[model samples]
Target: MRILDRNIIKYKFSFLLSCLLLLSGEAFSEQQRVSLRWKPSQGAESYLIELSEDRDFLRVHHFYKTKNFRYEFNSQDSKFYVRVVGINADGGRGVSSPIISLADKFAAAPKVKVERPSTVVASSEELRISLGDPKTSGPSSNTPGSPNSQKQVPVSTYYRVNGGEWQRYDGSISLSQEGWNEVEFYSEDILGNKETPKKTKYLKDTTAPQVRLIGEKKGQSGLIEIKSGAELTLQVTEEGSGMEEITINLAARDGSGAEVNLTLSGEEAKQPIKISSSGIDGLSILRWEANDKAGNYIQSELPLLIDAKHPLCVFAPTEGKLREDGIYYLKENGLIAIRCEDPGTGSGLSKLEYKIGNGSIQSYQNPIGFNTGIHTVTVYTSDRVGNKAELKIKVNAIKPDWQKTGSELQEK
Candidate 1:
């Protein structure tokens, strides 16, 4: 009769011999032999090997009866548990050794790490990669002849940039590309275990934001002339790292007054703003600075002169001179013309009208001629923004030379 009770066999053996896991042939090759060896028992003639997918050994994967004390097999998965039992020649089973997990004793894959910037940058930066020991979990067996008991070091590190050819990592890498970049890396240990490939990404921006000024009334002599309540627009754009902030400084050109400073966000800076001449009248300088997310900036200045007052009007003789006798003498073609100018900054003349003594109002396109007597001229003018000015001038003029000669001949 065969003795098959495992309970009787468990108490019959005093101690189970220590087990050893060894690897033969190439480290990670397909034909590598994963062997389990143990000390021979006194009354055992053959050994029984049992490999299970679970730790409890409830589900046996492989059962083999061998005459030798060692068993060799190829591992299809990364991890499993195995146990060995001593069998007597009478078909009776001896004590079974404790189940050992292959994952706790096998050589592990190397760990790879890539270091790069986390934020957006304005220029190229350096990238570096390193290799380290693989991480392990659970309590280590720390038994003699165990793979985890010894230290393992990575032998090589490999990397690729932007999906290009793979290369061994030797030194620091530079991200010189203008746009987005990607780097993939892996490490191999001395045991020929390769780590899973890892990827990292970053951005490199070398262009600055574009700035433009619009909605100005006119530009002249390195200055942008505007009315009191004119609209000025500042436009800024960036394609790479979007816009960040814009700062505007308005200071008096003469450097004798305080400055008016304003700040705007990326979205708000693209709209039009009103420039009031109530406080900042006369000549002023508008300096602006625009910045992007990549820490790149552009600075510029625009000279501005605010015109807030009405235009000045005056009447002057074109070809006549005032005599000592309180009368003004002029040639036959002598005439008086209206001259108009802005009081502050120039907003340009919009309307210039004049009337001779109680005459009908007329646009002042040419100089006005008067009869041989004292006369009064009324002038009215306005600027582009409706700033008006009116003036009245008294002029004393004599007849022309030809008229005076005809009068002398008539008297003779």
Candidate 2:
């Protein structure tokens, strides 16, 4: 027998497995049946088939000799590299065919498409996915068959959300979580070839941002008071999708109003938002509005009283006469008291307190009486909106004039 040229045998071996690989696995089953066929080569009496997990074929998994040109086997999610060699009449081996991988003969991974990046308020999020291989064709490809062509008919698909149990994918999936969502999916072809599992993430924000309004002081009747030219600020926060915008609507008692929208980006968003009280005074309303990236919104209103004057309090003796030196000379059994007043358009008086020298402070509900001694008194007062004042007074109650006159008469 003439020795065949190495290049010629290699070229002839290339066409030896014409349309040799075919996958005929059961529907939705793990056991897959694969079929292989080849053309007869000249001067060959039988064929040799080799299967391995490695490309170099150093670790051969299976070897078989047959006179026929077709073979069948069952694969349980196993991939292989295959080659064919020709046998001479005298039992000599010919050049081997080029290596081929079962992976190239299998379908690709499934494709997933999200309808929306995130769910907004009153809106639904839909997820659409396909089991067909993107590499073979877009979806459910109908490509023609050839020696190198691969069959990519997808049979079943499975998916899980947020680490839940695996469920068969039949239709669109809905996302309902408040924030980011985790999803995993995979598919199997008719050849029982399982695709590598894939993971994806998306958002589902549906809550609005939160806002806090801060003022100089708060008092009874839900009133917040601030001084003229005082700067005010608001604290805005978001839990999902982040803050998108902040707006302030200011309405004054004089029927004038203004609106301002804040920019939330870079260094500007980090800075405190100051609402100036430069020209507007008296009672005014501040309306705060905030929104998140998912279109959730919230609004609130704050009532402010802008006053520049401090409240005033006075001390007097109920049963005594005021002397020229601003001191009070009390008669026997005399009492002292205090009074507080507010300036024009100011918050009303809230509290009054007094204390003797080095004594604990007491709320002034009634007149105060001192012992038979010269004493110093300190008084504190405040208005409804935190305007405060203090006063100190001297009282002479050690020896009343009436008591002295009685003593002098007794001496006579």
Candidate 3:
């Protein structure tokens, strides 16, 4: 009785092994192998696999018998209605898996694009790259319930730097050093078919552009004379990249300023530029900057002083003057035309003031009319830079009856 009971328990345990479960399935391209795996049966001796077009095996295409819990297909099988059945040595049958399709399980490889900048300044530190996938009109064997627009994910990924050993890539990576950096990368499909390895070189630079002032810049005080609306061009040299932008700034000694944006097209870009100093005067600054295509940039500046030259006051009054006295003697109704001129400061001459004898100072407008009896006049002129010049002369405006020459009216 005891022996019979032990044999019954053994048979029950063996029967349970037939309830093995079908697990995962993987497929690659038509040139690669496909894999199907299942959970191990507890005490089963072997397993049976079938590929078909229907769940009931009505249109079975292939049959497989093996001792292990897994099976594999070659490049020949396009699709499968696959299932696995467990069997035990005691002639027991356990569970059977539901129907499955091993069709359209592979995807195309991922495409990659890389961008590299070779400027020494304001450039990215990483090796810039973008990913892409092509679209084609075709048929596939993916899951029926899944979306058709899903992207592909690599089963495995790897990379190499500077012809070094290949390493598994967990995520993204970067290039730390400047200059040329060589890289290689690829990924694998579910069936372990690796995509073609891609190789390329990336250029990295971090140097600023070289800048030099182009015009005649010669003076002990670094002095410069700028005309209004003048464009000052500078010679710029760049390595590893082309030019991008240029900027100029003019400001007063008190930090007041205006900025100028320069055009980089039209001419060869090497031609001289006119610097505009119109309406600018006194102590100021001339600053310039240059930028390279890769974002590298540099700046240069110098001190500027405005000196349009002093205004000249010509006291050539026609009313009265001894050719040798260099002084004017005028009648009460006589007129004196005043001329003030400045050729130096870019800034025009501003104020002109004069006084008649002991009268209050008056801003000069047109010609002057003299007062009677040996009047003294002082003329003052100022330029844009605050330069002032004064000339004094003695004049006498006598009444018509006074006869004011060297006679009695004292016209001096």
Candidate 4:
């Protein structure tokens, strides 16, 4: 008999729970009062209502118990989640109702449109958007304000071309599908608000001005040895939005103070600018900007590999005499240096790191000499393109031969 009673109780609880969840989720204005209503459960004597801002009822903000099926809630944001339960006269508790948010309780739909980037996507493919309509008061996006000053902000959803996955639109929007593509966009705000979807149609052209450079930037990747000057010629071809103008500027990166600049405009732009690598060697930056008739522009930059030769490195002691074992003896202490030079390049020798005997590696700036000790000098150097050379020489400072001879006679 007890088992039968337990089963009966469970069935009654489940029945009431179902009734609570079956209520209408939307808010209705009755007698000028906003409220939610539901049908009463069969065996329930009273209903329990729960409301919260979160989908999960863990942080329920309001709780109500009443005999009537209708429940009035205090919702400031008009946005909330709700659930209900029923309690019977026999102490049977019904299941909880399915949770629903009230954010759209009294909101209207929205209309979106493509506002900026000139409606057409020729110059740029990215889109700027704005929202319209959905009547609501208090800090709303539609409130009266300056065209530049916005009173409220809305959450936007982006539907890229080809019915792609939707994402929150953070002001700037883009269409992945180029050419003529149909993209959808919409916006919605909290507090019972949302907008309808608006489709945007446009075209995208991403082609830039074509470039034809001399030597084709190939077959010169290995060791570059240029004794004389290198002449560069360039040609540009553009279709659709014809080229308005083109300019190129070159800057040296080796801190050798080298620069090249050129600009051409209008019908006189057919002639290519001259680029002479006579003095400007090493790594150089070449920037080109081309403007079209449709107010569109293209910018391009390439690291120019100028034709130049590596510097010649020679180990000639500034002041020392050659001795045995590749060692040079300095009669006294002074200075000595390894000479390096790049005859044709603009930026000359790039690297000059050397390691002296039992000493840390240092950049060879000026001449190097020992105060009073046997010295082993090993130097490593290279040009901008990594043309490397190494040299090792041992040097020593010794007493003068006259001093040694005089000392020997006195001792005898």
TM-score of 2: 0.43
Q: Mind sharing the TM-score for model 1?
A: 0.51
Q: What is the C-alpha lDDT of each candidate?
A: 0.60, 0.60, 0.53, 0.54
- If both were scored by TM-score, which would come out higher, candidate 1 or candidate 3? 1
Task: Return the candidate ranking by lDDT, descending.
Answer: 1, 2, 4, 3
Compared with the true structure, the alpha-carbon lDDT of candidate 1 equals 0.60
TM-score of each: 0.51, 0.43, 0.37, 0.30
Candidate 4 TM-score, true structure as reference: 0.30
For model 1, the stretches where C-alpha displacement exceeds 4 angstroms are 1-119, 125-152, 217-222, 256-258, 266-278, 317-336, 343-351, 355-361, 369-378, 382-412
Best by TM-score, which number? 1
lDDT of 4 at 306: 63
Worst 10 residues of 1 by lDDT: 129-138
Ranking by TM-score: 1, 2, 3, 4
Lowest summed lDDT over 10 consecutive residues: which window, candidate 4?
17-26
Clashes of 2: 0
lDDT of 4 at 261: 80
Highest-scoring model, lDDT: 1
Candidate 4 lDDT score relative to the true structure: 0.54
Total clashing pairs for each candidate: 0, 0, 23, 6
Give the winner by TM-score: 1 or 2: 1
